[model samples]
Target: MVEAALFDLGGVIVVGPWEGFATYERENGLPEGLIRRINSTDSDTNAWARMERGEIGLEEFAAAFEGEALALGYRVDGMAVLNGLSGELRPEVAEAVRRCSERLKTGLLTNNYSPMASSERSAELAEVMGWFDVVVESSVLGVRKPDPAFYTMACEALDVAPSACVFLDDLGVNLKPARAMGMTTIKVVDPDEALAELEAVVGFSLRG
Candidate 1:
């Protein structure tokens, strides 16, 4: 039986500000999908992973990510892509989290940068993250999603077995590790559909 639910912060819990890159793509005359190109780089050695693991600073990430984008024939201001991450909470997902908390343990598992990047954003996000019983932030833990150990750490933090948890993330790559660990997984492309899937798995209404 599933005793816990795990959520990914940026894309799953809140809408990521993808418009910033849409605007950038329009103005720069670069073809669409530049930001994704930067993000889809080699995960282990990419600046994104390094920054989230607290091994590199934001400026370094910007520079390195830009270089990677250039190599892909897509030029973008990497800082803009980074800034685009601050998106509003998806109300449907938030309500589902509350309901899930009532029926099962909830956790916030995010691959994010250090608090030093933005004290204000960090402080504000912490208030909303209070819904979760356990929050495994990559910056704090120096580990990130897609790493088996990161998933294990989250399960340990929530004091639950991986087999008893259901995890959700927008990216399939992130969900793969959880599913491999025997945790049921959901890829959250559409909030309503994802919640509906969660409802099916947990046998409860998470809609509010």
Candidate 2:
């Protein structure tokens, strides 16, 4: 039985990187897949990986990422790429979070920048985040998703076994480790579909 529901903040809770990437591509006339390539690269040495871990600052990340993209035959604005990390909250997802909180332990397991760096988008998102019983931020923890320890820490913080928690994330790569550790994983592609899947897993109605 699932006692806790773990969620990813960016793609799972809000419109994120990909949406920003689309906007950047359109504005710059650059080839698509620039941000994708940057994020999908080797996690250990990639600029995005470093930034998300709080190992590097935003200014350094912008320059480092821009340099990498330049070698790939296009130039992208680093700040523009960074801007895609935050997005508007989905109302339905917010409602689902409150619903989940009523019956289960909910956690926010997000690979994000440091709290000092990421500004609150609005009162809504800040409040939605507050609904989670535990928030495991990668920047604060010095670890990013796909790292096994990150998953372990989230479970520990929530005080639930991996098997008793359902983890939701937009990235398949991030979900792999959780699945390996005996947690049920949900890939959140569309808001409605993902929430429906969550309802089925935890045997509760999140639609309210």
Candidate 3:
């Protein structure tokens, strides 16, 4: 039986920041979908993965991103761009996490960077993450998901074997490694459906 549930913060627990990127792109006079191009390009040496892995600090990341934008003939403020991309918490998901935490142990497993320490963001994050029994952030751990080590670290911190935990993430790529490591995994889409799927796996009603 699953003794704990691990959740990804962005996309899973909160509405993703895609809208923010759309706004940023529009304001910068860049072609629509520039963010997608940057994200999909292998040539873009500074991707979110590097930041998530703690391989680069925020200032370095912003500078590299700005350099890339300039090289592409897109002049814009990279810090403002990144701030726009950070997500907002979903109240329903926060409530679900609280209910789950009260019934069974719940934890957060997010691939995030140092900007999470911002006072404005921290207060918002605390309200959502406070519901979890253990919160594992990539920036703090110096490791990221899809890497077995990160998953192992989360399992260790939660004091649960991989098989005893149900892990939920919006990205299929992130969930694959966790499933391979013996954790029950859910790819979140619809929040209610996600809760149902999680309940089925863990054999507990998250709604109290």
Best by lDDT: 2
TM-score of 1: 0.90
Model 1: weakest 10-residue lDDT segment is 115-124
Scored by lDDT, model 1 comes in at 0.83
Reference-based TM-score of each model: 0.90, 0.95, 0.85
lDDT of 1 by residue, 1-208 (tens): 9999999877887775566667778877877776766777787889888899999988998999888887887666878777766777677888888888888999988888865234555544555577789878888888888899999999998899999999999989999989989999999988899999999999998886
Q: What are the root-mean-square deviations of the candidates from the true structure over C-alphas?
A: 2.2, 1.5, 2.7
Clash number by candidate, in order: 0, 0, 0
lDDT of 2 by residue, 1-208 (tens): 9999898888878876788887888888976776787667776778888888989999999999998888787878898777666677888988888888989999988887776236645888878877899888878889989899998998888899999999989999999999999999999998899999999998988886
Model 2: residue 164 alpha-carbon error in angstroms: 0.3
- Candidate with the larger TM-score of 1 and 3: 1
Runs of candidate 3 with Cα error greater than 4 angstroms are 43-47, 70-76, 115-119, 122-125
Give per-residue CA lDDT, model 3, range 1-208, as digits (tens): 7788899988887776667888998887788988756755653245566777778887887887777777777776768877886676777677777777876778888877763555355565687767787878878787778779999988888899999998889888889999998999999888889888877886766664
Q: Which lDDT values do the candidates have, in the order given?
A: 0.83, 0.86, 0.78
The residue-level lDDT of candidate 1 at 137 comes to: 84
* Arranged by lDDT, best first: 2, 1, 3
Arranged by TM-score with the best first, the candidates are: 2, 1, 3
